[model samples]
Target: MAAIQALQALAIDVMLPALGNISHDLGVTNPNHRQLAIGVFLICSGLGSLFPGSIADRFGRRPVVLTCLTIYVALSLGCSLVSDFTALLVMRGLMGLFVSGLMVMPMAIIRDRFSGDRMAKVQSLVTMTFMVVPMFAPTVGQGVMLVAGWRWIFAVMAMLASALLLWVWLRLPETLDPDNRQPIMPRVIVGNMAQVIRCRASTGYLLGAAVMQGVLFGWLNSSQQLLGEHFGAGEMFPLIFGGIALVMAGMNFINASIVERLGARRVSQTAVIVYILIAVAHLISLMRGEGLWVFVPFITASMCLVTFIGSNFASIALQPFSRTAGAASSIMAFSRLLIGALLGTVIGQVYDGTAIPLFIAMAIGGSLTLALVLYSEKGVLFRRLNPPPLKVKAG
Candidate 1:
């Protein structure tokens, strides 16, 4: 799971330093178009999730994941070999298509094995591992870019994918029982997705996840240019990125430790409000033309809160659907990536060598998230305050 998340993080962060190189090489005049390359990958990856739940239902998680890993490897190689930027972009989109399964299958496997508070604990553990990679990815990508050519980034990715393929082939087991497996027919696929969407508990958590992911995705779309180009922090980019990531990593650990005790709903609800406050403060500061140091710490805090919110919300949203793990994961993952990709593209386009747009989007996304959480839980924001535990009465 960590490897898959790391792979996803590397897809964007590894390309940061290479943006200029790619722009120059591809003869692209607009730097924002470079952002499109990243955005396209996420869009494809999100759309790709629509099919895999049903496929997993039919073929089982092991084969689907293995197939995805193989595709990720080949596409990574394709990315390395592409001569033009357009070809590389196309290859990246293809890579996302394959990697969508990586995001889905792992969660399905976890759900296959755990439930309720136990499942929530397991989800937090997996998310912590997933969080660790993004924390260091930018730094690692920068280190590689300094010593190797941009193309070598893809080469490293290909190698990593190949190694992971070996790991999967050796250790990953088929968790889906034949009796429980659903057919992969189109009607069944659409119906499964519809069922997930219609479940209010699921929908609320999914929307919360989407909003949290959107804030992060919007920041990612802006960060390379925002930090490296706008603030002239080119050399310090990795350290700054990693520092904020460290804050988020610490928060993830905190969530993992406290979530089962406090409950996922309470933790996530509180975090969303905290995210909103931090984002609003940052947005105000940017409007007032704050310094890089000022903006950096505030934004970092907001991101940390977002990380906390995302993990817990996912746990809460997914708690009710262990029986349909593959389909549930597919729905949530699909929603997050779709919402994130759309917002990322929008935020990337509005970049003006300023931090205002990024913060504005963050604030809006945070507000939207808190609203959804409130609606989902009958106008309650934090489960800690009221502690209205959801009852699963015996039939």
Candidate 2:
């Protein structure tokens, strides 16, 4: 499941180093236009997941995942073959549609097996594993670029999808029970989604998660430009990008270890507070004309906090639903991707050869996240809905 999720990271991060080449080869002259590749993929991926979640709940996890993987592979191949930018974007949108299944099914499977703190722990572990891909994907892209062209990157993705398809076909079992199968109908999906929204905690946390995800996406859409254009990092881009991802991965691992004890609420809420502080500091530093030394670390810390918040938020939001896991996952994913993609595109487009816009976006996103979390919890904070298991005293 971690490997399957990593495919999404790989598709995005691994292509970072090749964006310039892609723009040059595809005749994209405007620098801002190049970001469409990432933006379109995210939008399509979010929209595409809308139905797959319902389908997964109704049919089964394994079949839905396998079918989507097949489509992802085919689309990857199509992306590789497309010569025009418009055609490539169309293919990317389709690829994202299928890739949405890769995301939703795994969470449904996890939700089927665990809940509360244990579920959060499992999610953290999976996220830690998933983070490994982004940490190295840029380096991998650069390495491939040294030997081949940008198109080979898509080919590599296709190959990876094909391998994962085989693995799932052979090994993954259908986790959705026959008795719990939801009917594939619009009314049922709407009802389940409405149920999720009516639960204040779920809705609030979902919105908070979406805002936090927007911060991450905004960074991603602008990272290459930020590092390469503003800081003149040049060939060091992949290394620096990977280093930041490594920090996030380490934080996720730590969160996985302590979440069982601290509870998702305490950990996530605390992280959001800290994240907001970091964002404020970042904005101040930007206004004060701080250089990369000050800017980079603050931004990196903010990103780590985002991971902490995201995992916990997701676990908390989905805690209330067992039967509606698929629909819940879909709604959450869609909201995050849609909002994140829009925020990211705006941040990318607003790049003015300076760091101010990015910092401003981060600050706003952080503030919104904090507000959403407070609203979700109804002014109460740091209290766990599901506390850790009590330890018995040894006689």
lDDT of 1 by residue, 1-395 (tens): 66766677778877776777877877888888888778989888899886777788778999988888888888888887888878988898888887798888877887777665556667767777776766677777667778987778888888888898999899877888666688767787778778888887668879878877876888888888898878878878877887787777777777778877887777777777777788787777788787778878888888878877776677677766655678888988898888878887898889988998888888888888777877778786565432244444365
Give TM-scores for every candidate, taking all chains together and pairing residue i with residue i: 0.94, 0.96
* Candidate 1 CA-lDDT value: 0.78
Shift of residue 391 alpha carbon in model 1, Å: 16
lDDT of 2 by residue, 1-395 (tens): 79988988888899999999999999999988888899899888888877777888888888888888888888888988888899988988888876787777778888888889899999999999899898899999999899988899999998998999999989998887676789978899899888888899888899889887877888898899989778888988899899998999999999999999989999999998887787777788788787766767987898899888888898899888888788888888888887777878788889887888988887888888888888888989999776444343365
Clashes of each: 0, 0
- List the candidate 2 regions with Cα displacement exceeding 4 Å: 387-395
The Cα error of candidate 1 at residue 225, in Å, is: 1.0
As a TM-score, model 2 comes out at 0.96
Best by TM-score: 2
Off by over 4 Å in 1: 384-395
Error of 1 at 137 (Å): 2.4
